[model samples]
Target: MIQHFFLLLSIQFRSFFGAVANEWENNRLKLIAGAVTLLVMAGAFFFMFRGLFRYLASLDADLFGFGTALASRLFGMALLAFGVFVGVSSLITGNSALYRSERSTLLMAMPVRRSSLAASSVLQSWFNAGWTMLLMGYPILIAFAEGLEFTTVYLSRGLLLYPLLLLVWLSAGTLLTVLLGWAGGPSGWKLFGGIALIAGCGAVVFFAGGTSSDLIIQEAPGMQLGGLQNFVSDLPGQSRGYWPHSLFLQAMVKGNGNAALILTVEAVVLAAAALTAASWKFLEAWNRSAVAEVRYRSPMFFKDGGRYSTVFQKDLLMFMRDPVQWSQLGLLTGMFAIYVINLGRFPMDFTNPYWLAVGVFINISFSAFAVATMMVRFAFPAPSMEAPGLHVLIQLPRGRELFYGSKWSQTLFLSVIPASILAWFSTMSIGAGPLLQVESVGCIFITAFTLSTINISTGCLFMRKEAGSAVSISSGQGGIISAFASVGFVLFMVGVLSWVTKKYMTDNFTELMLAKPVRDSILYLMLPVGFTVSIASFRAGIKNLRERVF
Candidate 1:
């Protein structure tokens, strides 16, 4: 049985890695080039973070008696954030692994023990969440670890416990999945997304607001020896229910060998115990889930949306039903809200043309970059999203242009309209001139209009019907190409914006040097270019899909 489990896990790992490299099969040269590009990007970020941490280490926190405790606090806070992210990722993915997969039903009817089922599910979640957590944790950990000379115990605990910590989150998340199923029934566990979203938004708002306090505390002068303890204790009391996290901090900051040894033991024992407990209930929980009875749901806080055209309504409903998409969009909206709210609050010197121009420019470009990023996620997947329904649509409608138009209108309603409002608010948030405000909105509108059409058109051109699952679809080569194209287009816009700003700046601070009308003219010129590209792309794509599908 154990051998069988291990074999299954090995296959699962292969599938996951193969999915990541799914684009590599076609062209050897392209694969090599991609590998190089990814490595370069990773290396650039890693070294950049390392340099920042080294600088932070050099900063004299002597004012606050931060001498030794500063490292401990940093270690604690960073690990806590990382662990929360891992846990949520595990919870979301694990829920899908347990509930959404038909394999659960198949396995349930077999002779498989609940223990085996739970163990396999937990391991799969760990595998899914592990690489991401490691990649994110490593640069921060490695940078900090450099300063703390690695003793044998520190090396053992640090290397072992960080991964152990991730395992703990996976195990706990799996257990939560079981409980949610038990309480809510089959699809009941998905309610976790709602809870997670609320918590995440509150966290963003708090995090955004707390930066001022951190800055103040760091700068405040109070360098007596006792103040160090006071400073550390001043933080809100942490529950420390998660021992791996606590031990990680202890090992890093206090250099406690006992804590490290105990942590290693606890991690191994607790991992087994949690999985066993979860397995104890897994069969019963899954049986209840398989029944598919309708459990009562609480009243929704918001009313449903109004009806649009049939095609648009269908796409809108489809997008709303997917928890994965909603969660991502919710996070984006929350972060954007935090940014916009803080933009008005963060004081900028209007008297200094350099600061004023640069601040407003960054704020405007930030809005553009943000909308494009959101579109890549929401819009670019348009074609792949239709794979399951493509045959049905072809048999019924046979109107390719109508279908594409519906998507275009839905994209405007979903992505473009909201984004334009946000961009205008962001521009006004920083007190830009009336002309600048209008220009900012037009630029975003052009970006949204072009990107939306581009995504659907390019998506149709490269759509992969064989990639049945959302994860596999996004990993497909077509999706990758679409994303790269969107990014490149965004960069072109940012570059143009930067050049115009620079040109205007170098003209002796004369407001007339770059006249409002001229600036408007240059931006207006972009609309025609965007219009030409969108027409060509949209036409070719609809033509191809119509011929191929209908």
Candidate 2:
């Protein structure tokens, strides 16, 4: 029986990778393009951070041990932030693995033990989400470990501590899902959960907004550390139950063996506890998720959200009705609110026209990127969202257009509008003249429109057959390609816009060697460039669908 259970778990993993391998084999070109783009982006991010770290280290201020303490503090925050990111992401993947997977129903029908399925599902979620944490976090980590020698203690971090910590965190998410299921979860609880979440987010935004940004930076009080004595004095103080972050830093950054041992024991204890709980409760959760009528229905419980709107409106309803979808969106919105709450923290002198110009430029660029990021998640997987319903869609005339158009419209409403509002405020930050702010809004809109169009096209081209949460999809081949390609495109456009802003958006370019008419013409050329590319990409994608997809 034990052998059979292990075999079943192995099969689950094989099947998951098999699906991905098959997709990659069939679409080698697309996968290769995505891989290349991803590598490029990773390299770019690494170099960018490496440069920042070096700059900070080279700073004139020797306070806080010449930025070593500051680096440590920032790394500590990264670990905490990433731990939360991993937990939330793993939760999404866990939900998909347990309740949304196609294999779940089939495997449950077999005479397999629930523990086997739960074990396999937990591993699957770990791979799905935990890998992203490693991929994104490691570059920053290695960059910061610049001056440290390759000692045994430090090498342990690379080989042991990080992976163990990630696994423990991933298990926590799976364990939470099991407990939620055990408690007769969903239904009205989902609605209440959603409301509570929004309220909490609002409160955070309010608190942050009311707090001055300078106060935030000032309150973190740093010790002036220049040498060994300074280092000891500035070291994170020990507290009861924990040394605040000294243990974590010692284990992760300093590679202290004792700290490493502590983290190892903590990870082992956490993972063991979580897996044990999940193993016991999973079957119950599985039964409740589908078999129990109340668990199956959403909070409103009265109406089928699908019945109201048959096309575009239907997609909107679907997005709103599902808490899983909202979870991803809310996470992003909450993060954005963090910036909104502290807008005053940015040091922009409205009296200085160039500074105002730079401020607006930075804000609009960030807003555009944020909007694009949202599209790559929600819009890219839209094609797969049709899933087993493909037969139903294929039977209808012009179904692909309707579906894609609906997704595009929904993305615009949800993504573009919010991005524009933020860009408007960002423009307002520098007290920009009405004309410049309006122009900045137009530029942001163009960026959003171009990126969204490409996302829909890319999503349709690489749609998968499986059902997974947006996070899982975003982690998949299609999603990766869409995101990387979108980033590449955004970077190119931003670079161009940066030049245009410098030349035309500010006072005079003609006096600086380039004529105003020439700069104006160049900027005007970008308008058609974006519009033409968007139309061409959309048309090509639609044609591809007709030729192959139909």
Provide the global lDDT of candidate 2 against the true structure.
0.63
Which pairs of residues collide in candidate 1? none
What residue runs in model 1 are displaced by over 4 Å at the alpha carbon? Answer: 1-86, 130-175, 185-277, 292-308, 347-355, 395-398, 466-472, 503-514, 517-525, 532-536, 543-550
Q: Pick the candidate with the highest TM-score.
A: 2
lDDT of 1 by residue, 154-206 (tens): 44457666887777666656656666767654242255464364346336423
Model 2, range 407-468, lDDT digits (tens) per residue?
Answer: 66766676667777777776776566665666567667777888778888887787767765
Q: Which stretches of candidate 2 lie over 4 Å from their true place?
A: 1-5, 13-45, 60-78, 99-112, 147-159, 186-248, 255-258, 292-310, 345-361, 387-400, 429-436, 465-469, 500-526
Per-residue error for 10 in candidate 2, Å, reads 3.2
Task: In angstroms, give how far residue 420 of model 1 lies from its true place.
Answer: 0.7
